[model samples]
Target chain A: MADAPAAERAATGRAAAAPSRPRRLGRRILGGAGRVAAALPAALVLLFLAAPMAVLAISSLNATASLAFPPSSLSLRWYAEVLGSQEWAVSLRLSGLLVLLVVATTAALGTLAAYAVARGDFPGRRAVAGFALSPLMVPEIIIALSLLYYFQGLGLVNTIAGLWLAHSVVALPFVVRTVMVSAQNLDPTLERAAASLGAGRLRVFWTVTLPLLRPGILAGAVFAAVTSLGEVAVTALVSGANTTTVPVRIFSAVQFELDPSVAAISTLLMLASVLVMVVVDRFTHLSEAL
Target chain B: MTSPDPLRPAPAPAAGPAAHVVIEELAAGYEGTRVLDVPELTIRRGEFLSILGPSGCGKTTLLNALAGFVRPSRGRISVDGADVTDVPPHRRGLGLVFQNYALFPHLTVAGNVAYGLKVRRVERAERRERVAEALRLVGLEGYADRRPRQLSGGQQQRVAVARALATRPAVLLLDEPLSNLDAKLRREMRVELRELQQRLGITMVFVTHDQEEALSLSDRIAVLNGGRVEQLDTPERVYRAPASRFVAEFVGAANILDGVADGGGVLRIGDTVLRTGLPGPERGRPAVLALRPERVRLHTAAAEPASADAGSGGAASGVLGYRAFVGDAWHSEVHLAGGATLSARTHAEPPPLGSEVTARWSAEDVIDLTTAPAEEAR
Candidate 1:
C-alpha cells in the first residue's frame, strides 16, 4: 500500500513513453464495438415497443380528417369524441365493471387455490396446481373458440355474466401464479404455532395466514385487473351487443374504420395501467411479490 | 433472575404428582413409512420428560403425537384420566414452542403472548395482566411493545416460551427451541427453562437431539432409536446405567470393548477379567463392556501395579497410540497388546506416543451394554 503511488506513477510514465495514440484509438474502438453491439438489439426492441404508443398519442391529438401521427394541427377533438360517444361511453363502463368483477373473483378463488397447492399435503396437489395454471399457457384463440362452443351449448353466450366469467378465466392464472409465489414463501410453522396457541382453523387462517398473504393479494389484484381490462378474444366470443366491452368495441371499430378515438382510448388505457402499476409497486413491492 | 416468577403465588392445580399421562400402542407414519411406534409410555405430572434422539429418530414425531398435532394410527393418549387421542391440538390444551420460535411477525411481544387468551375470549383485563406476568416470568417485563424481530435471539426465544406459557396449559411441548441460539445463549436459556419448569411444577415434554441439554434439563430422558424407545430412565440412571448399547453410545462418549462373560458378574477380555456390578450373560458369551472415557485412568508403565490383579479389572498394560489436550481433559487412545484400542480421558497429559501405560476403570463405573432384540413393531 505504501508503494501504491510509486507504482501508479511508474505505470503512468511508461504509458506516456509508449505509442499512446494508436493504443487509445484501438481501446476506444473495442469498447465502443461491444457497447454498439449490445445496444443495437435493445434499441431496436425499445423502438418497436414505443413506436405504436407514440403513434397512438400523437394521432389521438390530431385535428385532421384522418388518424395520422405528427398531425398538421393538434387538438383534443378525438378525446372529446371518444368520451362523448354513447357507444364508447357504454363500452368503457362495461369494461370497467367487468374488470372489477374479474379482479375480485380471481383474487379470491386464485388465492384459495394457491393456498391449497402451497400448503396442502393431499394427493394430486401438484396436478391441481398444474391444471390451475394451464389456462395461462394455452393459446387465447383455442380458449376463445372452446368457450364459444361451451357457452353456446350452455345457452350462456352473449351474456354479461358470461363475459365476466371469461375474463376471470383468462386472468385467473396470473393471480394464482403471483399469489402462489408469496404463499410458498410463508413458513408453515407459523400456522402450527397459531394452532398451538389455541386458535382454531378459521381463526388461524384469518389472523395468521391472511395477514401474511396481504402483499401477494395486492399484487395479484393489480395484475388481474390489468389483464382483464386488456383481454379481447374471450370477450369477443362471449359478449353480446348489450354487453360489449371497450376492447371488443375497439376491435370491431378497427376492422371497419381507422378512428382517432381508438388512439385516444388506447392512450387512456395505457395511462390507467401505468397508474395501477405504480400504486401496486408503492404498497406491496410488486417486484418482490412476483 | 433466579427468583421464581411473581405471577404464580400458589400451585392452583394440586402441584404433587396428580395426573398421569398414559400412551398405549401409539404408532404414526407419513406416506405409509412408519416414523414412530411406542408400545406404552407414561409421563408423570410435575416432571420434565425429554424425548432425546438424533434427527429422524421419531422424537419430534412422538412429541407431535402427544400434542395432538399428529394422530396416532392405533393408540390411546389420555391426560388426567381423560382420553384426548381424538382431540385436535387446540382442544388438547397442550402448548408447543416451534424450533424457529414462529412468533407472529405482525404482532408485538404483548400481542403474541395475548394470543391464546384472545382466542379463548378471556377478559381483556385478565389477558393484559397475564401477558405482563408471562413477560415478567421470562424476564422481559418492558418488552411488550417490541416486535419479535427487534429482540435478540435469546429474548425472542423467551417470548416464544412466554407465549406458550401464557395459557398455563397442562403440559408444554418444546421442539428444539434452543437450537437457534448461539452456544452461550443456549446454555443460559437451558438454565432458565429448567428453573421455570421447576418453579411452575408443570409437566413438560421436551424433544431435542442435544444429549447435554437432555442430561442437564430433564427429570427423565427417553433415548429413542428407529421408531422405538431404547431406554427410559432418570438422567443419572440413564447416564450411569444405560440399558442398551445405543443409550450408552448416544448419551455419551463411550469405549465399547468386546469381552467374554465369565459368569458370576464378570467379563473376561484379552487376559483381563473385569468385575461388574450387573450379572454377566451366558458363560463365555461374547459381551461388550461400555466404559466412560473419563472413568478410565491412564498410568505410566513404571507406575503400574503388580501384574496378578491386572486382569481383575484393576489394570491392563498398553502402548499409548495418541494424545490430545482438549482444554479440560486429555483424551488418549491406548492400544492394548491384544490389538484392541481403548480411549482414556485424564486430567493430565498422557505418556509419550508408543510408551507403555495401563488403562483402568472401577468395575462399577463400567456398564454392561446388552442390546435387547428390538421389537419389529413396524
Candidate 2:
C-alpha cells in the first residue's frame, strides 16, 4: 500500500510537470483547423481569378480547331498565326502608342492636380479636388457615351487623339488618387527647411518634394499604362477603323469568331499586365502607394 | 544728445558698432488674431538669446516674425542694419532649425549640407569644401554618405545644424531644436549647442519651454507671457530679482504667501507678523510675497524658537504630510498651523510622515511683488 501511494504521487508529479501536453495538443489542432479555414477561401479566390487565364493559355496551344478543355495535343499554331497577322501587329502597335500617351499625360496631369489638391489652399480648393476626382465615381459607359458625343461634336471621331483623350480621362483619377496620397504623406517641413536654406521656391520643390513623390508618380504611371493598354469600352466608342487598339480588335474578333487567336491575344495582354505589376512592385511598395 | 551733422559724410554710417539684429515694435498675428507684440528687442552679434515661454505664449511667433516667416503687421526687422522685413525667408540671410530637425530624408547628409550652397550658385569646388567643413564642425565627418533616416535623432539634428550653418547666414534661429531628444541627450546637446554657438560667434535665438534649458544656455532670456515680454534679463537677475510675480513664478516654482502690510515695515499673515525688506504701505494694504522653496528651512519644534529673531517663528507645528526622496535632497510638504501648506527642500533627509516640523524663512529671502494676487499673476 505504501509503494502504491508513492507510485500514485510520482504519477501526479509527472502530470503536474507536463501539464502543457494536452493544452499544446489542443492549440495545435485549433491552429491547424484555423489555417485550413483561412487557406480554403484564398485558394478558391486564386482559382476563380486564375482559371480563365489558364484556360486561355491552354486553348492557345491546342492542336484542335475548336475550344476544348484538356486538349488531346498541344501546339503553337495559334501563336504563330497571331504573330504573323498584320491586323494584330497594327492593333498591338496602336495599343502601345495609346499606353504611352495615356501614361505620360495622366501622370503629368495627375501629379500636378494632386499637388494642387494636397498642398495648395486656394479658394474652392475642396470643390476643385472633388471635381477632379469625380471621374472615379462616374460609370465608364457614361464617360464613354459623353466622350463619344463630345468628340463627334468636335469632329475628332475615328482618330487616335480622341481615343487617347478618352483613355487619359479614365486613367487620370487613378494617378491622381495614388500620387495625392503620396504627396499627403510627405513632410511639409522638408520643403520649408529647403527654402530656409537659401533654396528658391522652385528649387525646393524640385529637390525635396519631387524626390519624395517619385514613388507615387511611378505607381500611378504603371497603373495608368496597364489600364490604358487593356481599355475596351471607351476605345471602342471613339476608335475609328484605322485607330483600332488591341482591345477593340479583340472585341471585333470575338463577335465574328471564338477561336484560339483571341485566347492568344488575351494571354499576351495578361502577361503584359503581370509584367507591369512586377516592375511597379520592384520600384515602389504598392501597399504604400495605395 | 546732439543731432548728427548732415554734411559730415553721413557720420561714416555710425561706425562705432552695430547690433546684428534689431527688432523694433514688432507686432504679428495669424488670420487677424494678434499673437506677438514685442515693443523692442535687439540681439547683439555673437550672443545667444533664448525666448522662454509656455505654449501659446508667442515666443515661436516672435522667432517666426524675425525669420520673415511671419510678416509683422507693424515693425521693422533689420539684420546687420539692413531692413529684411519685406524680404522673403530665403533672402533674409538667416538660418532656421526647426523642432523636428527637418532634414531632407531623400538626400544624404552631404547632399543636405550642400543644398544651400547649390541654391546660392556658389562655385562647385567652394561648395564642396564648405560642405565638408560644415559637416566636420558638427563632428559628423564620415556620415556624409548616409541618409537622414539611417542616422539617430541626435545625428540628424547635427546634420540639420550643419546644413543651416553652411551658408554663413547673419543669424541662426533654433526653434526647440533639442526638444525631441531624450532628457540625458538634451542636456548633452544643450552643452554642445552652446559651445558651438560660442565658438561660431553668431547671433542665435533659441526657443524653448523648459526653464532649465533657457537658463543654462542663454546669454539673455526673454520671458514671455500672454503675447508680451514679461522680463528680459540675465538668468541670475531674472531668477533672483524677477520684475513681476509672473517672472518669479514662471522661471522657477515659488511659494506665494499673501499678506497685508501693517504700516510698520512688517507684513501680517493671519495672526502672525513677519518683517519684510519691502517698504511698508499704509495700514491694511494687500501685498504678495514670493518665496523660493530652497530658501525656506525646515526645523524640529525644539529648534524653532532659536531662529525667531531672524524671522517669524510659531509655537504651533504641523504634521509632515508627504516626503519625497530626491537625490542628494529631501522634498517635504508641511501643513502649517493656519491650514496653509509650504514645501521645504532640505539637504538632509526629512522626518518621516506625521512628524511635527516647523517651517521658517528669513525676511530678506521673500520677494515682494505689487501684483494683484498669485492666482492672477499667471
Candidate 3:
C-alpha cells in the first residue's frame, strides 16, 4: 500500500523522460483501453436508468393521440392537450395539494418520531424505531389493501382527506429514516452543555436541538414531498372519483385508451422528481440524507 | 493494624473558609451497581480542588453528581447550605465544561459565550458586554465572529472555558478539559487555567486522570480508588506521605517493599533489617512500606562516609543494576538481596553497574501502608 504511489510516480517519470513516438502511441492506447474498461459498467447502468424515461419523453411528443415512439411527426400537441384538459388539470391540482399536505404531516411526525426513537431510552425504544421503519419493508400492496378496508370502515372513501392520510403513511418511513440518521449524529453533550449553561429543557430543544437537526428535517421534507408525489398504490386504493391523482388517472388512461397525454403527464412527473432532487441536493447533500 | 493518622483531617473550624458545596452520604450508580459513594465531602469557597483518579474510579461520576447531571440515589447535595439534590441541571446554577469542548457548532464564538446570559433573560446590551468580557478573559477578543470549527483545539478549549464562566455561577466544574490538547498546549493551558482561577477567585472543581496535571493545578487533590477517596490532601503530602498503597503507586513511582514489622519502629525484609521511623503496624504482622524514588539516596559502599547522617533512618545495600540520565535527574535501579529491586533518583552521578551501594532515606519520609484494605482489581 505504501509503495504503490512511489511505483506510480516512477512509471510517470519514465513516461515523461522518454516520450518516443512508438512508446507514446502504445501508452496512449493502453490508457484509452483502461479508461474504457472503467467506464463501461457505469455507462450501462446510466443507459438502463434512462431508457424508459427517454421512451416516455419521445412518445409524449407524438402529434396524434397515439402512445407511439418515433411518431410520423414530432409535435407538442399531446403536451398541450394534457395541460388543457379539465380532467387532467383536476388530477394535477389534487396531486399538488396532496403533496403539500403529505410533506407537512410527514415532516412534523417523522422528525418527532426520529428524535424520540434515536435519543430516548424508554422501555420500547427499539420497538418504536422498528415500527417506524416497518412500512419500508412491508409490501405496498399490503398497505394499500389494508387502507382500502380501513378507510372504507371509517367513511373516508373518495375523500381528499383520506388520500392525504394515505400518502402521508406511505411517505413517513423515508422521512423517519433520514431524520433518524441526523438525530443519531447529534452530540448529546451539546444539550448537556446547554443545560449546564442554564437553559431549560424547552429552551435547549428550541435553541440547540432544533437548529442542529434542520438539514435532516429539510431533507426529510423533500423526501416526503417526492414520495407522496410518486405514490400510486395506496392512493389507488383510498382515492375516490373526486380525488383521483395524476398517477391514478394515468394508470386508468394507459389501461384503456393508451393516450399520449398519459405519456406527457408521466414525463412531467419524472421532470418534477428530478427538479426536487436537484434542489434538495443543493441544500443538503442528498447522499447524507439516506 | 491501625489506619494512618494524617490521612484524615478534623473538620474545619467555624472561622475557616466557608463551605461552598457539601456532599453528604452521597451514593450514585447506574443499573444498580454503585460507582460512587462519598460519605462526606466538602468544597470550600474559592478553592481549586481536583478529583484525581484513574479511569473507572468514579471520579467523573462524582463530578457529574456535583454538577447535577447525575442524581445520587441516597443522600443530599447542598450548595450554599441549600439542598439541591433533586434540582434539574439547568436550575442548579452551576457551570460544567465538558472535555470535548462542546461549543455549539452552529453558533459563533461570541454567540456560544452569550448563550447562558441569553437564557437568563439578560438584556441585549448587558449580554454583549458579558460575552465580550468572557472572550477577553480567555484571550479570545477578536475571535467573536469566527465559528467554533475555525478555531484550533487550544482556542476551542478557551472558548469552552469562557462559555462556562460567562454565567458567573457559584462554581465551575471542569472535566479533563485539557486532556485533548497536545502536550505543550496542555501545559500552557494548565498554567493559564491556574492563573485564570486565581485571578477570578472562583471555586473550581477539576477532574483529571493525569496525576501531573492534578499535582500542578490543584490546591488539594482527592485521590480516588475503587469509587472511594483514599486520600484527600495537599499535593505535597499526597506525594510525600501517601495514605495507602494504592495512592503511593498511582500518584508516582514508588519502591514498595514487603517486610515484617517488629513493633519497635523496625522492619525485617528477607535477612535485612531497616528502621522505618514510623510506628510499626503489629508485633509480628507483615507490613507494606512505600518510599519515593526521589527520597532514596544512593551512596557508594567504598565511601562509607554517611555513618552519622544515615544511622537513624531507612537503609539498604544493593548492587547497581544500571543508571541513566533522565534530563533533570539521574535514575538508577538497585538490585537488592532476595530478588528485590529499588529505584533511586538523584542529581549526583550514580555508582557504576554491578557495584555495591547503600540506599538511604530519612526516617520521616517512610510511608507505612499495611492498614489499607486490599484494593479490588478493577
Candidate 4:
C-alpha cells in the first residue's frame, strides 16, 4: 500500500518524459496508415448513402415524362411542371404549414417533458420518461391504425387539425429524445446559483434553464420539422383530400402514375432538407446539438 | 481596495451582533439516516464563519440548512429574529458561491451580475450601476462583456463572486469555493476573499474540508465531526486549546498519548512515565492526552537535562528514526523505548538520523482530552 503512489508517479513520469526515436517514427507512419484505413470505410458509407439520391436527381431531368436512368436526353421540363402545377403546389404548402405547427407543438411539449424527466425525482419519473419516447419504440403502423380509428370517431379525420395532430405524435418522440439529452447535460448548479441570487423558480427557468437548453431545444425542433415533413403512414390514414401533405400525395401518385415528375419532386424535397440543415448549422452549430 | 457603498444597513443593533443567524435543534438527514444534529449554533453578524470537517461529516448539510437548500426535519432557523425555515431558497436572500463557479455560460459577465436585479424588477439604470460596481469590486470591471467560457478558471471564479455579491444578499454562503483552484491561486484567493468579506461587512458562511483554509480565514470555526460540532471557537482557541481529540488531531499535527494517570501530576505510558502540568486523575484511571508536534523540543542525548518544569525526560530518550525538511522546519521522528513514536517540529537542526535524542516539552502545553465525549457513529 505504501509503494502505490511511488509506483504510479514513476509510471506517469516514464510515459510523459520520453519516447524512443524509432518508436516515434513508427507511430507517425502508423498514424498516416490508420487515417487512410479509417477514411476508406467512411468514404464507402457516404457513397452508398448518396448513390440513390444522385440517380434520382439525374432521372428528374429526363425530357420524356418516363422515369429513366442515364437518360438519352435531359431537360428541366419535369422540374418546371412539378413547380407550376396547382395541386402539387397546394400539397407542398399544406406540408410546410403542418411541419411548422408540429415543430412548435413538439418543441414546447418536448422541452417541458424533458426537463421534468431529467430533473424531477418524483415517483415513476423513469416510467414517465419511457412513455415520452414510446412512440419510437412502437411500430408506426400500429400508431397509424389507432389514430385512424380514434380520429374517425371524433370527426377529426379529413381535417387539417387531424393531420397536424397525427404529425405531432410522429415528431414528438424525436424532439423529446433530443431535448432530454440536452436537459441531462445541463448543470444543475447554474439553476441553484440563479435561485441563490434572488431569482424565483419561474425566473430561473426563463433566464437560466431555458437559455442554456437552447441548443438541445433547437436541434429537437429541427428533428421535429424533418420528421413531420416526411410523415406518411399516419398522415395517409388520417388526412383527407384537402388535408393531403406532399409526402402523402407523392405516395398516392407513385402507386398510380410513374413519371419523371415524382423524381423531380423527390429531388426538391431532398434539396429542401439539405437547405434547412445548412441554415440550422449556420445558426446553432448543429454538430454540438447532436 | 476601495470600499464600495454599504450593500444593506448593518443588522439592527437591538438584536445584538451575536444572533445574526441562529439554528435551534437542527437535525437533517437523507432517507431516515441522520447526517447532522445541532442543538444550537449562532453565527455573528459580519463575521466569516467556516464549517470545517472531513467529507460526509455533515458540514455541507449544515451549510445547506443555512442556505435553505436542505430542509431540516426539525429546526428553527432565523436571521435577525425572523423565522426563515419555511422559506424557499430564492426567498432566503442568501448568496451562494459554488465550488465550480456555476456561471451562466450564455450570459456576459454584466448580464450574469444583473440577473438578480432584473428578477427583482430593479430599474435598468440602477441595475447597470450595481453590475459595474460588482465587477469593479472583484477586479473585473473591463471584462464585463466577456462570456464566462471566454475567461480563465480564476477569472470565472471572480465572476461568480461578483454575480453573487451583486444581489447584496444578507449572508453569503460559500461551499468549498476555493477547493477547485490550483494551490498558488487558492492561497491568493483566500487572502482576497478575506479582504472582500471584511470590506463589505457581509456575514459569510464558508464550508470546506481544508483545515488550513478554515484556520487562516475564519474569525470563528465550527469544527464538525461525525455529524456533530466537536468544537466552536476562535481559530487560536480551536488550534491551541482543542476541546476534543478529533479537533486536536484534525486541526493540526498532534502526538496522541494514551496512558494511565498516576494521581501524582504524571502519566504512565508502558514502563515510561511523563510529568503533566494538569492535575492527574485518580490513580489507575486511563487517560488520553494530546501534545502538538511543534511543542515538543529535541535535545542531544549527551547534553545535560533541562530544568524539571520544562518536563525534562530522563527515560524518554529514543533513536531518531527519520528526519524530513518541511520547507520551514525540520520534522524528526523519534522511536521511543516503549515502542511509541514521538514527532517533533523545530527550526534548529537536530541530530542525524539513527542517533539517540531526548524529546521534551513543558507540562503546561499538554492538552488533556480524557474527558472529551467519545465520537458517535451514525
CA RMSD, predictions in order: 6.1, 6.7, 4.5, 6.0
True contacts kept of each: 0.78, 0.78, 0.90, 0.90
lDDT by residue for model 2 (A129-216), tens:
8888898899888989999999999988998888889999999988998889989998887887887987778888788888899889
Model 2 DockQ vs. reference: 0.70
* Model 4 Cα lDDT, one tens digit per residue, B1-378: 122422222333224656789888899999999999998888888989999999999998898888888999998999888999999999998999999999999999999899888888889999999999999999999999999999988888899999899889879999999999999999999999999999999999999999999999997889998788888877777888888888999999998887898886677888757666567788899998888889888878677464553444222568899899998999999998768888899998878999888787776678888888654522
- DockQ of every candidate: 0.71, 0.70, 0.76, 0.74
| Off by more than 4 A, model 2 | A1-20, B1-18, B262-282, B305-317, B371-378
The 10-residue segment of model 4 chain A with minimum total lDDT is A11-20
Model 3 error, position A220 (Å): 2.2
Which pairs clash (backbone N, Cα, C closer than 3 Å) in model 1? none
Q: How far is candidate 1 from the true structure (C-alpha RMSD, Å)?
A: 6.1
Using lDDT as the measure, which candidate wins?
Answer: 3
Please, what are the lDDT tens digits per residue for candidate 2 over residues B149-243? 99999999999999999999868999999999999999999999999998999889999999999999997788988888877777776777777
TM-score of the B chain in model 4?
Answer: 0.92
lDDT of 3 at A119: 95
Interface RMSD of 2: 0.9
Task: List the TM values for chain B, per candidate.
Answer: 0.88, 0.89, 0.91, 0.92
- The local lDDT score (0 to 100) that residue B283 gets in candidate 1 is 89
What tens-digit string does per-residue lDDT give for candidate 1 at A1-290? 45644565687775343345776588679789999999999999999999988888888888875865688899898888888999998988888998889999999999999999998889999999999999988999899999999999988798878888888888999888887988999998898999988889999999999889888888888888988888888888888888888888889998888868888898999899888888878866777786
